[model samples]
Target: MLPPPLNHTSSILVIGAGTWGCSTALHLARRGYKNVTVLDPYGVPSPIAAGNDVNKIMEHKELRDSNPDARSIAFATCTRAALNGWKNDPVFMPFFHETGVIVSGSTPDLIRHIEKDEIDSSKGDFITLKTAQDFRNTMPPGVLTGDFPGWKGWFSKEGAGWIHAQKAMLSAHREAKRLGVKFVVDDPTGNVVGLIYQNGDVTGAKTADGTVHRADQVILAAGAGSDRLLDFKKQLRPTAWTLSHIRMTPEEAKRYRDLPVLFNIAKGFFMEPDEDNHELKICDEHPGYCNFIPDPNHPGEKRSLPFAKHQIPLEAEARARDFLRDTMPHLADRPFSFARICWDADTPDRAFLIDRHPEHPSLLIAVGGSGNGAMQMPTIGGFISDALEGKLQKELKYVVRWRPETAVDRDWHSTQNRFGGPDKVMDFQDVKENEWTRINETEKSKKSI
Candidate 1:
C-alpha cells in the first residue's frame, strides 16, 4: 500500500545526501514543498558516494528496448526524461559533456544484439565498427592508438556521453540550499542510527548523538547503506564495482580531449580524461563484489555493507590492464594514480525500489540504484516526489513498487548485463594483502569507514 499523500507544508526528513537524496530535496523544493531536511555523514558530493566521482556515463538518446516490455520501457522513458533535464536544466548543463559513446564487444551474439537494437530503434546515425581500423576512424588519427583487435560494436553521437559527477552533485546541493533545504552535515547529527516509531508509525530518525528529528514523512535514500538502516529482506543486494585512474601528461590529455566514452563488455570502459587534472579513469567489466558482515541491527543475520577502502583488488587492476592493453597498449603498463571500489544497491531485477514501507507507513524507501543512479539523477527526485504525493505515473510506480515476495527467491542470473554469479563476486574477507593494490601517501591519509 502507498503511504498517505503529503502536503506542501509537510515536514519531510531525508536521510543520505548522495545523488538521489539531494535530488529529492531539490525537486521537493521546486514543487513548493516546505520544511525539508537532509542529513548525511558528509557534506554535498560526499567522497564515499558512488556518484561522487570524476565522471560517469550518461545516456541522452531515446533508445527503445528490443523486447518492449513494461520494465524496459520504463527504464527508457526515465532515461529520456533525465537526458532532457541534463540538456536544459541550468544546474546540470555545466557538468554535461555530450562527447558521444562507443559500445564495443568481442562476443558475436552481443554484437548482433546491438546491431538489431540499432535497426529496430531506427537510429540513423549509428556507425558500425567491424574492425580495429573502423573503431579508430571515429576519433582523430593520433587517438585510440591501441589495436582494437576483434572489436565489433557501434558508435552513436545522438544519445551518449559522460558527466562531471562530483561537480554535478555539488551544483544540485547548492541549488537545493538556495531553495531553503536544511542540511545536517555534522558527524553525530548526520549519522542516522535508527528510525523513531510511535503507534506503529514512523515519526522521525535518531542520529548517532541521540538527536531524534521529528518529521511528517521520512525518506530513506541512503544508497548502498539503505539495507543497514532497515532490512529490505534481500530486496536490495549491496554490491560494488572497481574503478581506477591513469594519470596522463597535459599534452597526452589534449590529444584525447573530446574522445567518446569507450565500453567493451568483455574488457572494460574509459571516458575522456579530466580536463583539470588530466587523469583518465577506467573500470573493469565483471560482476561486482559483495562485503558481507554480521548485521549489527539484526545480530544473527548477515548483511552486505559498503566498504570505503581506497585500494582495489589486484585482480581488478589486472582486468583494467588487460582492457588497456587491448585498446591502448602504450598506457597498459602505466601504474594507476588512484583506485577505489564504488558501491551500489542492486535489486534482483535491476529496477529501482521506490515505494513506502508496507509496515512502517511514514517511512518511504527510495533506493535500489542498481548502478544507474548517476544517469537518473535529473528526474529521480521527481519520481520520488510524485510517489510521496500519490501521483506517480502508473508505469514507473508499477515497476518500482515494493514487493517482498519477489525478494524471497532472487535470481541474480536473470539480471541483464551481469556476467557471473556468486563465484565471480569476490568476498571482502577473501582479499589478501597481496591481492590489494599499494595505497599511495595521498590515499593513505584518507580513512576508510
Candidate 2:
C-alpha cells in the first residue's frame, strides 16, 4: 500500500509583468508548471517600467578588486554562462549585442583580470593602451582626454556589451505565454489592489475593482512598486538613474561611430552607443532620481516610478551638461535630445531580495535591482522559479535574504554627482519640501503600526 500520490496542481500568481515577473513565468513554464500566471496594471513592457529602457549594460564579468576572495565573483561566473546562453540562442541573441565594454580608471588588478579573461574565454578579447599617442592611434584622438588625467583602462571586446532590454523582455513574455504561462494585464477583473490571505497565510490577491484572484502562491516582481503592494517598504527603496542623450551631428556620430561602450570610473559616468551607432547615451550611474507617486489612500506611503506625466527636474538637466563637459567636451555644447530618469527597486546592500515573504511563506517577492538588475534578465528567471519550487541553490539564496538597513541608502546617496552647481540634484525629495523627511517619518509610523 503506497501513500496517496502528491497533488502537483497548485496555481501560481505573479504581479507585475516586468522583467523579474516575466522571467519567472518563463522559467516556471520550462519547469513544467502548467498554471503560472502574471498580473500587471499595464500589459507586458509597461511603458514606464525601468526594464523598458532603450539599453542596459551586460557586464561580461564581475570586476571587484576591493575583495579578491569575495564569493560574488564566482556567482558572476555562473551569471556569465547564462548571458552566453542568450547570446547563442537565435531568438534571443538579437537583443544582446556583445559590442564590448571599456572600464577606465580601474586598478591594476582589474586590468589583469581582463588579460586573464581574454586568454581563458574566446568570447572576451582584451585591449590596453597608454600615453596620448597610444590613445590617438588606438581610439578616437579625443575620447580619453585631460578629463580623465590619471586613468589607465582596458577593454573586453567579447562577451561584454549592451542589451535591447525592452525588446528582449517583450519577447520573453511572449515565449512564456506561448509555453502555457498566464499573463493578466489590463483585464476586466481590474488591477490588483491588495493581497488575499487566510489563517495567516497569503492565498492570493485582490484587484482594484474588488475582484479576487486566488493562487497557491504569489510572486510580486512589481519592480519599485513592491512597497505599495507588500509591506517590504523598509527593505526595498525605489530608485532611478539619470540618463542623457546628446543629439550628435552626422560628422560627430561618424567620429564616434565605432567607439565601444565606455565606463569612466573616476568621473562616474558610462556611455552606451545606440544600435544604429548614431545616438550616444550617457548616464552618471550615481544615485539617480528616487522619485515616487504618493499613495493617496495610504497617506505617507509612496510608489517609486514615473507615471505617464513624470518629468525630469532642472538640476538633473544641468548635471548632464556638466558631465558632458567633464567626459566629452565636444558633445557638451551640443543640444540634448532627451534626458530622463530610469527607476530601480533598490535594497540595502545593493543586492536583490527573492524569497518567500517574511510573514507569509506562501507569497514571494522579487525586487531591489539597485540599478543593475536588467542585465541578469537571462538568468534571474531560473532563480525565481527555483525559489518557488523550494530548490533555490544556497549561494544566491544567502545573498538575497530579507535584510534592510537605512544606512545603506544614506551612504549610497551621499556620493552625489554635483557636476558643477553645489545644489545640482532635484530628485523628488529635493524638489518637494519635506519629501525626504516624509519617507523617513512614514517608515517610522509603519514600524509603530
Candidate 3:
C-alpha cells in the first residue's frame, strides 16, 4: 500500500542471495547501478546454499558424449572466457584455482563436439588419455578402471579447474558492499513473506515484520526456494545431493595434491580432492534426491527447499563405496570424515530458468541451477544482468524465458546434472545424521559395485 520504494529510474531488489543473486548484485554495482539491494534468508552464499562447497569443478569439455555436446562445448568456451577474464581481477582471482579437470567416458558425440569447436589438446588445452592406465596415471598410483576398464577420456585445461566456494562468494560480496550495494540477511529485517503486487505489477516485497520495501524491479534468484514465493512449484523442484568426504594418508595426500577433478559421467559420480583438508570428496550426480523438505516458516507450503540431511543415505553410499573400491581400491576402507546432503534447485528440463514473471512486469526470475550453478560463478550474474537490461544474446535469450517444457530430450540436462540414473533411493529420509558413523561401520565396510 505504501508507494513503491523503487523509482522509475532503476531500483533493483534481488531475492535469494546465492550464486546468481550475489553475482548479479556485484555486477550491477560494478555497472554503477546505485540502488541495488539483495535480500536473503541465509545471506549471500549461505553456508548451506548449493554453491557453498569447498571446491567445485569448472570444466569446459562435454562429458555427456552426445550431439548436444556441441552446444555444451560452446557453453563451456564462454564460461572459460568469463572465468579467465575475472581471475585477472585482484578481488576474485584469489578464489579460483586452475588445477584442471579430468573427464572420462567421452562418447563419440563428445569427440565430434570437440572437433566442431576446433579443440585440439596439443594446443595445451587438453590431453587425450587413451586407456585405463592413462587415466590412472593422472590419479594416485592405482585409482580408476574396472567398470571403466577401457575408458578413454581427456584431461585438459591445465589452467582450467575448480573453485573455492566461500572465497568466490566473499570476494564478490565484498566488492558489492564496497560499491554501495546493500546486502542483508533476512533474519534482522524479516524473511520475505511474498511480493508486493499492485496494478497488475510486482511492486516490491513485504517482510514478516509488516515492512514493505517497494521496488521498481525485483530479481528472484532464490535457487531452490523460489518456487513457493513465485508459485512455480510444478516447474521447479528443490533437489538434494550427498557429498561424502574421506581423509587420506600423507602419501595419498601427496599424490593427489595436484589431482584434477574426476568425473565419470557414464558411471554417475564425481570426485574432488580437497588439497586443504588432505581429503577426497565424492557425490552422486545422477538420481539426485527427489524427496520433499519442510519449510518451517511457510507451513503447508509443501516441497519447500529441502534441508541438508547430515547422514549420507545408503543408496548414495553404495555407488560411492564402489567408486572407491573399483576406481581407487586403496581408499576403499578409509573411514568417512563426514557426509552431507546438498540441496539445489532443478527445473523440469534441467536447463537454467531465468525469466520475468509472466503476470508481473517488474518481477524477474532467476532460478533453477540444475546442479551446475557453481561453474557459472564467473558469468551467471552477467547473464542475468544482460537479461534484465534487455541485452541477452540470441542463444541465451531463450534460456531466460519461461517455458513449460524443453523441446530437447529429457536427458538433455542429464549430462551436466546426470540426474535419473539406475540407482533409486525410494525414501529420501531413510538416513539421519545421528547414525551416520554407525551406518558406515555396520553396513558398507566391504562393498564394491
Lowest summed lDDT window (length 10), candidate 2:
440-449
Error of 3 at 224 (Å): 0.8
lDDT of 2 at 331: 68
- Per-residue CA lDDT of model 1 for 1-449, tens digit only, reads 44556789899999999999999999999999889999988877776788888899996545455557777777887888898888999988888889888877776775676566533336546778888888788887766778777678778786678998888888889999999999998578998989898888889999999999999999999999887788788788888888998888999898888888988865789998997778899999887888878878768766677868778999889889988888888899987888888998988788999998888888989999898888888889999998888788998899999977777756433334564223266677778878899957674454221
10 residues in a row with least lDDT, candidate 3: 408-417
TM-scores, each model vs. reference? 0.93, 0.78, 0.80
Rank candidates by TM-score, best first: 1, 3, 2
List ranges where model 3 is wrong by over 4 Å: 1-9, 62-78, 106-126, 140-150, 186-190, 249-252, 268-272, 293-305, 405-449
Report the candidate with higher lDDT, 1 versus 2: 1
Query: What is the C-alpha lDDT profile of model 3 across 353-418, one tens digit per residue?
Result: 777777776888888887778778767888888778767776766654687655323331233325
**Per-residue lDDT of candidate 2, residues 270-350 (tens digit):** 444554434577766444555556756558655454443223455555665565665566666665555555667766666
Estimate the overall C-alpha local distance difference test score of candidate 1: 0.83
Backbone clash total for model 2 is 0
User: In terms of TM-score, which candidate is strongest?
Assistant: 1
Candidate achieving the largest lDDT: 1
